[model samples]
Target: MTDHALQSPPSAPVRFPPGLIFACLALLGVLFLPLPETLPVAGQRMLAILAFAVVVWVTEAVSYEASAIMITALMAVLMGTAPTLADPAQTYGSSAGLSMALAGFASPALALVVGALFIAAAMTHTGLDKRIALVTLTKVGASTRRVLLGAMLVIVLLSLVVPSATARSACVVPIMMGVIAAFGVPLRSNIAAGLMIIVAQGTSVWNVGIQTAAAQNLLTVGFMDKMLGERVSWIDWLIAGAPWAVIMSLVLVALVLKLLPPESDNVPGGMDGVTRSLAALGPMTAAQKRLGGVSLVLLLAWATEGRLHPFDTTTTTYAGLVTLLLPRFGVMTWKDVQARIPWGTVIVFGVGISLGSALLSTHAGQWLGAQVVEHTGLDTLGTLGVFAILSAFLIVIHLGFASATALTSALLPILIAVLQTLPGDFSRVGMSMMLGFAVSFGFILPINAPQNMVCLGTETFTPRQFARVGLWVSAIGYVLLLVFASTYWSWLGWM
Candidate 1:
C-alpha cells in the first residue's frame, strides 16, 4: 500500500467500531478467563498481548507503527515477567523479550519487503511505473470495455514490479481518472466507477498470485520458515497461484463490466487522454531504462527461484535494490526515495512477525490449535473439507479487521496451530500456502483493504457501490477457490 498515512478513506458507517467492541470483550476475557492446564503462563500472557495488539490495530485507535511499538513493549514486560514452564524458578528477561520483539526485523522476509519498497520507490522516482502504465493503457483503444481491460493490464504489470498493492493502486488510480476525464464523462459515471473498481480489485487478484506482492504474504513466509521449518519457494508459489490469479483477473473484469456497465460503448478521445499522458511523460529517460532492466532481472530471478538459480527471492531482490542505489550505476539516491519508504510499515511488519513468533515459541499456538481441534472436530473432516471451513472462516473474520497484515498476525498463528493440531495425513505446507492465499480475500468492503480505500478516495464509487461488486467477487472467488482446490490444484498436487 502507498504510505498508509495517505490512504485513509472514509470508513463504513456504524454506531460502534468492531475494534472497540472486541477490545472490551478481550479485556473481560483476560481478567476472567482461567488459564487452561495445557497452556503455559507465557502462553496466556501472549494471548493477552495478542488481544491488545488486535484491538489497537483493528480500531486504528492508534497508528499501526505506534501499535507495533506498544506491542513490543507489551511483549517485553508481559512475556518477560511470565514464569517459564522449564522452571517456574526463572523468568524470561525483559531485555531478552525486547530482542524477541524485534526479531522480525532480522527475517529474510522482512528484508524482501524492504527491498520491494525500495524498488517501488525507484519506479516512482524514475517515472518508470507511470510510464509503463500509460504505455500499456494507451495500447488498448478508449472504448469503455477495452479501457477496463487496459486498467487490468496496467494492474497486472505494476503488481509485478511495485509489490505493494496500495502503491500499485495509487499509481494506476490517477491514470484511470485521467482516462475518465478524457472520455468527457462525469467521474460519477458507470465507466469511471467500473475502471476504478477494476483497478482496486485487480491489485487484490495479483496479490494472490505473487509471493512478494503483499506484506501479509511475506508474514506467512516468515511463519512457515519459523514454524514449519520450510518455506515455499517463489517459483512454486507462482505455479500454484498464477493460474488462479489469471482466471480471477478475467473474472474481475467481467463482473465489474457486468455490474457497472459503462456510460458509453466507445469512449471517443479516451485513448487520446491516455496518449496525451504518455506523450507528456515524453521519451523514457536513461534512468527509466536502467530501472526497467533491473526490475526485469529481479523479476526473472524471482520466477527462476529453486530452478535456474539457488539464490532465494530475498537475496536477489536486495541485489537488485543495491544496483538501484549504487553510486553511479543506481537509479535513485537515498535522498530521493527515503521519504517514500513508509518506515511505519517496516515497524508494523517487524512487530507483527515478532508477535507471531512469540506465539509459536511460547507454544501458545500449539495450545490454541489443540483446543480448536478438540472443539471443532476439524480432525474428522477430509482435506477438502478442512480447506473449505478454514477458507470460509478466514473470509468471515476478515470483515472485522481492516488490515490484512493485522488479520494475518492475529489469526495466522492460530490457523497454523489449527492445522498442526489436526489429526490425519494431509499436506501441512500446502494447506498453509492455500490458507495464506485466503487471507488476501479482503473483498466485500471498501475499507476491507487499503488498496480498495485508495481507490475509494477517488470518489468514483461509493462504499456501497464498491461493496456490491465486492460481494459478487468474494462469493464467486470463494467458489472458484473450491473448484480449483477440487480439480486444478489437486491435479497440480497443491492440495
Candidate 2:
C-alpha cells in the first residue's frame, strides 16, 4: 500500500475548545466587570483568577496538576502587577506574588496530607490493607446480603488505615471480585453488582467520618487553620462526623439490598471463599505486624491529640512514617513506594491552599462571599436553616465536578468568607466543620468519586444501578445531616 493509504486515520477533531475558551472568557469577564467602590483592583484581579480556576477545573481544560501550575503562573503575573490593598499606588511585586501562589505548601495540613499518602503507600506495598479487608469479610457472614455488610465494615476499618478513599477502595475491589468468581456467579449478577456498588459508595460514606480519610478533608482542615485560626482535631472531627457516616453506612446497605436483591439469598461457599483467601496468605508477615502496630499507635495518637497529648495529627503521622522508613524498623524502602504514590495530588493540594490564601489576602474571597450572602439571604436564616441551605448548595454544585478536592479548593474559601460575613450567631469553626462534612457528598454519579470509578471498572454494575442507590443515599444522608444539626450536633455545641 502507498504510504498515505498505509498510515492510520487521524483522530477526529473536537468540535471546539470549550474548556479553554470558556476559561479565558471567564477571566476577562470578571476583570472587566463593574468594580464595586469598596473592592480594590487587586481584589478584582484575584476574583478574575478565581473565576478562571473554577471554569478550567470544572471543564477539566487540562490535568489538575497542569491547571495548578498554570493558575500559579497567572497569579504571579496578575497579582505581581496589581496594586497592594495597603497602597493602590504601588504593585505587590513578583516575589511576593510567587510566595503567595506557593503559600499552601507550608501548611501543617498539607504536611499531614503528605504523611497520609506515605502511609497509604506503605499499606499497599505490604499488602496489609487487602488482608484486613478479607479478614473483615470472613467475619461479617456468608450470605450475599451479609457479605455486603461485611464490605461496609471493611470500608470503615480501611478508611482509618488507608487514609485515602481511592486507595481503600482499590484494596477491596479485587478481593470482592474474587469472591464473586469463586461463587461461579456471572459478573453482572445482582450479588456481584451490589457488592461492587457497596465498596464504592461505602468508601464515600466513611470519607465524611474521618479527618484523615481523604484529601478533601485535609483541604477543609487547612482552610480552617488559615481562616479561623483553629482546627478540628482528628478525634473531634470523628465525634462530629462519624454519626452521619455510621447511619449512612447502614442506609447504604439497606438500600442496596432492597434495590438489587440477590438471585439467591446465600453465596453458598462465599464465606468459605473469603476464609480460603485469607488462609492463602497463611500469616501476617513481619512487615505487616510492624506496620499494623505503627498504624494502631498512630491512630491512638491522632485520637488523643489536644486531649491527652500535645503533638498534632501531622506530627504523629510523621513519626509513624519515619519508623516505616528507618533501616531496621522500616517495612519498605523508598524504592518500594516511590512509584506508588500519586504525587500530583500533593501538588494540587498545596496549590489549592495557596489559591484560597491569596483570595483572602487580596480580599477577593471576602468580596465574593459578601455578594453571595447578600443575594442568597443567608443572614436572614436561623443556624439550622443556613446549614440546610448551604448543605444543599454543596450537594447540588457537587454534581458538576468529579474531584471533591477541586470543588473544595474552588468554593470553600468563598464559603468560609460567607460564614464570616453572616451577621448571625454561629461558631466559626463549628459551622465550618459541619459544612466541610457536607463537601464529601460525592454520591450522585460514578464520575464523582475515584473509588466509584474503580468499582465501576469491573463491569459488574452499571452507572444506572449506582445512581439508583446514590439517589437514596444522598437523600437519607441529607435528612440525617439536618437531624444531626438540630439535635446531636447542637448538643455537642457544634452548631
Candidate 3:
C-alpha cells in the first residue's frame, strides 16, 4: 500500500456547545434520579453511562478521547456507588465490584490494540509499506484497470502483515498519488475518487479473511474464547472467512468501477514509473529489515498460539511490539512510537472492554438477550432461521458504529449471550465468527470505519456518495456472506 499524505482539514476551534451541555446534564439527571423497577441498580448505572457515551460518540458532543475518558470515569464512580443483584451479599464498591467496572483498562485485548498501533507505526516509520506497494505495482503492469485490480490485491495481501486498515490506507494513499501524477489525473477527477474508494473499501473488506487482520476480529475471538470456551484457529478462520473476503474484493472492484467510473481508462506509463520507484528504493533499510523480521515473528506466534497455548493473544502481539521497541535491535524509538500510536483508539477499546465486563457482571447482557429472544422468538425459527436473523441484524447494525473495535467490544458479548438461548446445533462460535466478519461491513458512511475516514480525508468522495453507492456494495456483500454462512459454513460443520 502507498503511504498517502492524509492530513484531514482542521475543524473549527472547540467551544462547549450549549445544546450538548444541556443534553448531557439532562441525561445525567434522568439516569441518576431513580432506578427503574425492572433494572438492577448496577445495570442501570452501566446502562446510563453507556447511553451517555454512545450519544456523545454519535453526536460528537465532545471529542472522542474526552468521551472515552468520561465513560470510564462515570462507570467507575457510578458502579462503585450502586448495588447489584449479582452480589446481594456485598456492596457494589467492594474490590470485586470495582474490578467489574474498571477491568477495561486492564483488559488484554486493550493491550493488544496498543501493541498493534505500535506495529503499524513501526511499519510506517520504516517506509516498509511504500516498498511493498512499489514492488507489487511494478509487476502488476501498465493497464489502468489492471493497476486498480492489482492495487486491491495489494491491499488484501497487506492485511496479512499490516493489521491496521488505517495504516494500510495511509500507506496506499501516497502511492495512489503517484498513479494520479503518472496519469495526469486531476485530484477531484472520477479516476481519483474511484482509486481512493477502492483503497478504502478494499482494506476494510479483506480484513475479515484473516483472524489477525483486524483488531475487532481479535476482540471477537477473545470474547468467544472467554464466553464459549471455543478457540478458532487461524486456519479455521481463513477457511470460513477467506471466501467471503475474496468474493467481496472482486465485487468491490466491479462496484467502484461501475459507481465511480474513472475518467481515464488507461495509464500509459504507470508500470514503468512503478518499476523506477522500486529501483530507487534499492535495498531494504535496517529499520525495514527489523520491522519485517518482527512482523513475521508476531504473525507466526499468533497463528500457532492457539495450539501451543504458550501465551494469550495480547502477550504474543506485545512480545513482537516490545522487540520492535528494543533499544539496539528495534526499528523505532519509544518516544516516536508513542507520538504515532492512536491513543484514542486504545482508550476506546479499554472503555469498551470495561463496559462489556460491567454488562456481563451485572447480568445485563443475559437480561437484554432474553428480552430480544422473547420479543423476536428467534430461537424458535430453527438453526438456519436463527442464523439468518442474527446475521441480518449484525450486518445492518454497522450503521450505528464508527469504530469496528468499539463495535466488536460492545456487541460480541451480547451476541454470545443471545446465542446461549438457542439450540445446541446452532454453533455459537460459528455464528459469532460470522458476526465478526460483518463488523467490517460498515461501508455506507465515511464515519463507519477508519478506512472510510481516511478516504474522506482525501476530499474525493462525499458522504452522500458513500451512503448511496456504498449501500449497494454493502448489500451485495451481505447477501454473499449469508449465502456462504448458510451453505459453505454448514458444509464445513461450522453452522
Candidate 4:
C-alpha cells in the first residue's frame, strides 16, 4: 500500500497557541472587570473565572480541557479557595464540574444518539445501510434530477435514524460517490450541489421533528425548564416545532431543486424502476431488524412522552436500557455497541453542558443578558428581532470556533435570559425561534459544522458552491423563523 494509504487520520491538537492563550486571558480579565465588591466568595469567584475559561476553551478560542486544568490551578493558588492541591483536586470533581461531565451520560438525547450509533454500526456490519443506499441509487438510476430528489429524501429519512450530521454524511457520501461514478456524472454537477444542501438541511431540520433529534433541542428543553420550572414535554415540543420543521424542510428542498436543476438525461425512468431496484435488495439483517425494532419503540415513546401518564422518562430510559442490553438478548453485543458511539461527541457535549452550568452558576449568562437588554431595549418584537439577527451572525462567527456545544451552551443561556425579560407569551416564541434557527444556520462554511466538513471531503460540492447555497438558505431560513415566531407560533397557541 502507498504511504498515504497506510497513514492514520490526523487528530486535532490538545494545546493552544500563545496568541490564543493571551486572547483567552484577555477575555477572562474582561469577565472579571469591576469585580464584585464582595468577590462572590473566593470559591465562587474562582468558579466564575473557570467558567469563562471553559467558554473559550470549548469554543476552540483556546484548547479543550486545558482551560479546565487552568481553572483548577487558579482556584488552588490565587483564590486560596482550597487549602492544597488535594483540596482543589476535590473541587475539580465538584458537583458543578462533575454534573457537566455527567451531562452526556445523563441525557436521554445523548443516549438516543448512542443507540443510533449502534444501529448504524449494526447496519453497516450487516451490509444493510449499503444495501439500502445501493437500492436507492439504482432505483433513481442515471436521471440527475431523480437522483437528487431521491438522495434528499433518503437523507431526510436517515436524519430520523442518525442524530449526527457528520454520521449521516458518512453514510450517504459513499452512496453518492458510487452513483457519480456509475452515471458518469461530473462531481461538480448541480445534482452534487443539491445533495450537499440536502445533507446540511437534514442535519438540523428533523431536530424539530422529535426531542431526541439534536442535542440543541434538549438544551432548549433544559433552558425552558430553568425559565419555566418544567422542561417542555416531548409531545409539546413536537406539536410546537414539527409544523415549522416540515414547512422549512419542504421550502429548502424546493429551493435546492430550483436553484440547481439536475441534468435532463440523468433522471430516473419511473417509480416502477425505483421500486424494482429497491425490491432487488435482499432481506434485512438481524441487526437491522433488532435496531429498527428498538428505534420504532423509541419513536413511540418520544411521541407519547407526556400523555402516557405512568412517567415520560420511563419510556426513554427503557429504550436506552434496552439498547444497552441488546447483546444479552442476542441482538448485539456490548463491545459491538461500544465501538460505535462517537466518544468525541460525548466529550464535546459534556463540556458544553458543563460550561453552560458554569455560566448560569457564575451569573455570566445573566451579565451578558443584561448587557444585551441595556443596549437593545427589551420590547417583545425588538428582542425577537435582535436574537434572530444576532443568532444568524453568530452562526457565521462559529466557523472560527470548534464546538457547537459550547457556543449554544453560552449563547442559549444568555438568550434565554433576554427572553425572560420579554412578555411571557413572547418569551417562549422568541427563545424557541432563536434556538431552532441557530442550529439550522450552521452552513456558511465547512468549519461551521462537522457535517459540512464531512460533505466537503466527498469531492463533490466545492466550498464556494456550498457557501452559495448556504447564503440563500440561511436568509430564507431566518425569514421563515421570524414569520413563524410572529405568526404561526402564536396561531398554534405555543405562545
The full ranking of all candidates by lDDT, starting with the best, is 2, 1, 3, 4
Tens digits of per-residue lDDT for model 3, 39-83: 687776666666676566656677767777777667667777777
Residue pair clashes in candidate 4: 142-266, 143-266, 143-267, 144-266, 144-267, 327-332
TM-score of 4: 0.80
Q: Report RMSD (Å) for each prediction in the order shown.
A: 6.1, 1.5, 6.5, 6.0
Would you list the C-alpha lDDT of every candidate in the order shown?
0.86, 0.90, 0.76, 0.59
Number of clashes found in candidate 2: 0
> Best candidate, TM-score-wise?
2
Q: Count the backbone clashes (under 3 Å) in each candidate.
A: 1, 0, 6, 6
All candidates' TM-scores?
0.94, 0.97, 0.89, 0.80
lDDT string for model 1 (67-178, tens) is: 7887888888877788877888899889878888898899888888898898988888888999989999878876888888888888888988898887888888888888
Per-residue error (Å), model 3, residue 328: 3.2
Whole-structure CA lDDT of model 1: 0.86
Q: Model 2: residues >4 Å from true position, as ranges?
A: 1-16
**In model 3, where is the ten-residue run with the lowest total lDDT?**
1-10
Residue 183 CA error for candidate 2 (Å)?
2.1
